[model samples]
Target: MNVLLGLSASNGIGIGKAFVVPESEKRVISSKKIKAEDKPKQLERFERSLAKVTGQIASQLDAVKGDKVQSEIFETYFLMLNDPEFLGDVRKSFEASNHSIEYILNQKTEDYADRLRSSGNAYLSERAEDICDIFGRVLNDLLDFHPFDIEQVPDDAVIIAKSMAPSDTVILSKRRIAGIALTDGGVSSHVGILARNYGIPAVFDIENILDEIKTDALVIVDGTSGEVIESPDGVALSYYQNKITKAKEHADKLKVFRDKPAKSADGESFQLMANIGTVDEARVAMEEGADGIGLFRTEFLFMSEANHAMGAVHSKVAAFSEENQFNAYKRVLETMRGKPVTIRTLDAGGDKIISSLDVQHSSSEEKNPLMGLRAIRLTLANPSLLRTQLRALYRASVFGNLKIMIPLVTSVEQVEEVLAFAEKVRDELKSENIPFDENVPIGVMIETAAAAMISDCLAKVSDFFSIGTNDLTQYTIGVDRENALVAPLYDEFHLAVLRLLHKTIKAAEAEGIPVSVCGEMASRTESVMVLAGMGVRTLSMSPKLITSVKELLSKMSIDELKAISSKRLNSL
Candidate 1:
């Protein structure tokens, strides 16, 4: 068995023949400068290509009317294509350098992309891909290159590619492909977002993948674990097939609990909702019987130009006005149609910074973004930026059950400041006669040890608590999960993290406020039980994991889980 490990972009099981999607190099064939007189003609050619791409984007919007995620993808491209800075900068470069349109476009975009890539913010760096995507399509159009059509791909074939554009995923999804594996692409990429939208099994970031797997080989993709198997023997095939069967059976069984309350065997009940980044994911969560959206990652609205879905983006929101932010919240609120949606404010810093918002621009140069001013700290430091989002959320709250959450909070002072700012927005809305939710829920994310330690204080002033285990584990244990060499040291159920969780949950329960486990940890069956045992009555995770998690919750006894927790705690 040839085993390949990658990042799970989407979840599912699939077995199919590998259909390699060949990648073509995109580059300017001619770099020679045009004469002064030919500059106008070159400029005209550039405008025509831009117009064509614009038309294509408009058509996509028309085709996909209400798919906000997909619509945002095209809309960002349209924005980039028509962005005055981008267009004007490229034109200036051509005028000065007299370079070919392809050369000028490539050079200017790369220059902008380089700034973003070197911003030291991981999520912001990913926007380099967006810049490349927008300009690369225009480059291809200018060169008269006819790209491969997704419609021509074989049906039910596993798509193997080095990388995929959002459009490629969009078009190929309609072709009924079995799965997708990419040597390039992050779980936060636009294509990754589309994969989740269509429920396609996808794994990405597998290095040297094309050279490892051959075409026509039977491959088994376990998207949840990010494992892809090539030419599995009889035993392995049976194992994967049985696993698939069991998963489906499990899902079907959980369907009975769709309308049922999440009450434990001992009569302890919990709020089970979905953690989503986009509006479509909210719809999926509702279909999977989620009570409400426990975690609505509003970061996707800011990073729409980059990866575009499933929030938790530690990056910057640039050139995004109050109207832009307001419309994003309204779109999501409209989609949820009154289901409770918790919107986490910008968690910028430590690898997530909006270069534009970074007044000092010092954050983009920070060696350690994870430990730097991020989340609440970043928002507090930039009150105007915070107000921009607060106003939007406050305005959009009237459309649905909206709750605003502050992320990476470590102090009551920060919570107080945020609340004051929120109150200011509410007052302004009222004064302006703008319709808004005056009593929208205000919450704090219990991610850092400081925040978890003082949960009682935060709970006193907060309406709810969401435990962000992904960061809690990393920070409490002093391990950067992103560092490959030290990733193995990271453990979600570590004693330190468990202790923090126990304290926070108890504090929230004491205050009579709802506490939720909204991290990836809440998705696992064992972790879910442990969380419930620790007194966490609300759990939020990805939409896809809802059925399985609910299924496991339905089978387990809270009292027994508490017993296990006691035993483990005693041992620890």
Candidate 2:
């Protein structure tokens, strides 16, 4: 028996025969110079190959149109394929350097991918895979080579790969795969997100995993524990089999809470909401017995519209149009069926870069972008961006309960600025005979230390407070969580961060405004208890974690949670 431990990406147990993905044969591009007159023909060939790959990716997009994350990833391929700026650079290179199109394409794509990989942001680094995947398809088409055929992957096989791109991951999701084991993938990678969404057991960052696991070998992947056992003995295999059974049983038991309201042992009811990025997730939240959506991250809607679809490359609207935003928000609102949806207006820039936003200060220009123009700052600077979103949101508000939340709000002035802009939008809509909800609530996200510190004043202007611990932890601790060198120090449990959470909740409660946690910390079982004890009555997290959190809260009285929270706050 061989056991290997890796980062647990998804929670589940998967036992199946290993199906190691075979590496494709490396292409040998001829570096010989071509005639200058041949440039037009080479460009034509490149366009043809690009067209073919674009068609392939479109088909993939259609297959996953229901899944927002999958579709967003596939849409990025369209952006890369149709990016005039990048393609123009490639064309210039083709004209200047009389090299083969394949060589030029390979070199250019690698250069961009390398730059992104070295950007120090894990999300951007993962996007490097998308660049290579799309360009690789184009290169393959140019070379008349077919990549790994997903059709041959047998059902219930444990897929082992050095690394996986979203392209391969999307296709593999259709199968009844036992699990995924990767030597190169981060917990925040798109592949990892897809795995968790699909409820597939996945373990990533297993060093030299492909070499250790052979094809058809009996493998047990314990994603909950980040354990991989290959060729396990009967005793080990039996142990994992029992674990799998118990896990399934536990999942089945959680289903009972689907229709039950979240309440404490002492009968105090609490709001258990879901933090979602797309309309599809809203439907999932309902199915998961969520009270409402606490955080509807609007940045995703902007990200999905990157480069403005396939054929409409240079559309007049750099980001999602009012109509596009309206339809998306409307769909989510309609899906929730009158449930309160707190939609945070575009939290773009910073780590969540939306190229479509066309911010004047790009990450390349800013030395430290995380604290630079992002969220409320970006939207406030560009009134048109926030105006378009506010119009769509208010327009969609008529469909259901809507609460507008501004992100990265540092002071009451930022909230006032957004309110001022929103008023202008409302007046314009009224004059235009557009119907919208006039009483939609506007809230502020307590993500920065500045916001949390002045929550008492912010509560005077804001409708409610949503604690975004993900950013709050990093900001309060002065550490970038995405930075591997300093991520360990970015702890939500730190005394400072806990104090901020406590402060935010207390301030909101004092002002008679609801306070909720909608960050990664809310998704944690222990963190939920701490927050509930700290006087937060609402907790929003991932849809998949709702039942477990609900279950945890059901067993613990408010007093018990308060004790736990007090102990942690006083000690830690």
Candidate 3:
């Protein structure tokens, strides 16, 4: 038995035969010159390949089922497939250099991929692989290369790969994949998010994994410990078999709590909601018995509209249309089916910064975006963006129980300004005799020390308060959660962060306004218990964590949780 250490991208345990998914070999294109007459034929080939790849993605969008993240990953790929800039670049290269279709596409993909690879933004750089995946398909089409058929992968096989793109995850979800092992990929990557959402055991950064293990070899994937065991025998195999049995038993026990309320042993009932980014997630949350949606991040709708908006200078229209925005909001609201849905307006910044949504409509090449223009600051600075979003939210409000919340709001004046602007948009809709919910509740996120301090004032003007513990901890303690060097110092259990949460919740309680903690902290058992002890009854997190949190809540009394929280915090 050989134990290989890797980083856990998702948590679970699985035992299955290894299935090595080999990467598609790139075909060599002719680097030779072409005649002017051949240029037209070569350009035609490019367009045909584009249409073929576009159809492939469209088929996946229709065929893929159950997973929301899978659809989103493909949607991003769809946007890339139709990108006018990408098409124009290929055309220019083909006409100028008189190169073959294969050469032009290969060059264009590599060139754009290089820029994204060197962009320094993980969100952008990680997307470079998706670019490679997209163009790889088209290039394969032009060269008649047989791409890897993921559908034929044996069901219940542990997939090992050198690298896995977001689209690859979409393909995996279509099959009965047991687990995942990657030679090189980050846990913060989009595929990682998909893995967790789908509850697949996954590990990454296992160099030369295919060489270490053979196809059909039995493997044990311990996502909890980030260990992969190859060809286990006797005692080792018995131990893992027992481990898998216990996991199954625990999961079965948890299933019994699915329909139960998230209440402490003493019967202190609480609302457990899900933090979703898409309408499909909303469906899953409802399936998991979620009370409502704690946070619906709207930025996922405009993730890369900047592609066209940035290219508009040459010749392309921005994809930031209000109708598209309204549809996204309407779908989620309708999916929730009268359940409370708290939608956070675009909180794009740091790795999430999209320049097309920017006030100046500029590229996001900032040295430091986390502390710079972002969230409500970006929206407030650009009234047009805010108004567009406000109009969409209002239009969608009539479909369900909608609650609009502002993100990164630090000042009372900012709250006032947002409220005033929302009202103005509401008035415009009314003047036009547009249909909408007239009394939608407006709220603000308490995510900064300043916001926590002035929570009393903000709570008075706001209808409700939701604490974004993730950023609140980051800003209050001066630790960037994304920076690996300083991330170790980023402790959510720190006394300072606890103090801020305590202050914020206390302020909200004084004003008789409901407050929910809609952050990562709400997902963990101990942290959820601690926050509940802090008088936070409404907790929002991933839909996958709903049952686990309920199980933990069922085991302990509210008084015991309060005691544990008090003792734990005083020790700090």
TM per candidate comes to 0.82, 0.95, 0.87
Q: Report the candidate with higher TM-score, 2 versus 3.
A: 2
RMSD of each: 5.0, 2.1, 3.8
Residue pairs in candidate 2 whose N, alpha carbon or C atoms collide under 3 angstroms: none
Query: For this target, which candidate reaches the highest TM-score against the unseen true structure?
Result: 2
| lDDT of residue 138 for candidate 3 | 89
- The digit string of per-residue lDDT tens for model 3 on 1-572 reads 87899888888887899998887675878888788887777777777887788778867766764455666566667777766667887777777886677887888898888876675555667778888888898888888888677666688899888887666676566667778888888767777777777778999888779889888999988888999998988898899889889988988888877788888899999999999876668888988989999999888767534333321332233436788888888898888889999999988766674535235633245555666778888778777788899998899888999999999998989989998898899899999999999889999999898999899899899999999998899889988765546767988889988988888889999999999999899988789889988888999998878999998888899899998789667844
Clash-forming residue pairs, model 1: 314-352, 316-353, 316-354, 350-369, 350-370, 351-369
Task: Tell me which residue pairs clash in candidate 3.
Answer: none
lDDT of 1 by residue, 192-307 (tens): 77888777889998988899888788998889999999889999999999998997887777788877777777677778888877656776877787878888876655655433
Clashes of 3: 0
Descending-TM-score candidate ranking: 2, 3, 1
lDDT of each: 0.78, 0.85, 0.81
Q: Tens digits of per-residue lDDT for model 2 on 1-572?
A: 99999988888889999999987678778899999898889899998998888889888888887777788788777777887777888888888897999999999999888877776667677777888888998998898987677567789999998877677877555789999999878888888888888888999889989789999999999899999999999999898899888878999999998899999999989888999888778988999999999999888877677534567654223778899899999999999999889999998877676666345555534546677888889988877788889999999999999999999999888888889888999999999999999999999999989998999999999998898998898888888775556767878899989988888888988999988889988878888888888888888988888998878989999999999999989854
* Cα TM-score of candidate 1: 0.82
Clashes of each: 6, 0, 0
Q: Candidate 3 at 296: error in angstroms?
A: 2.0
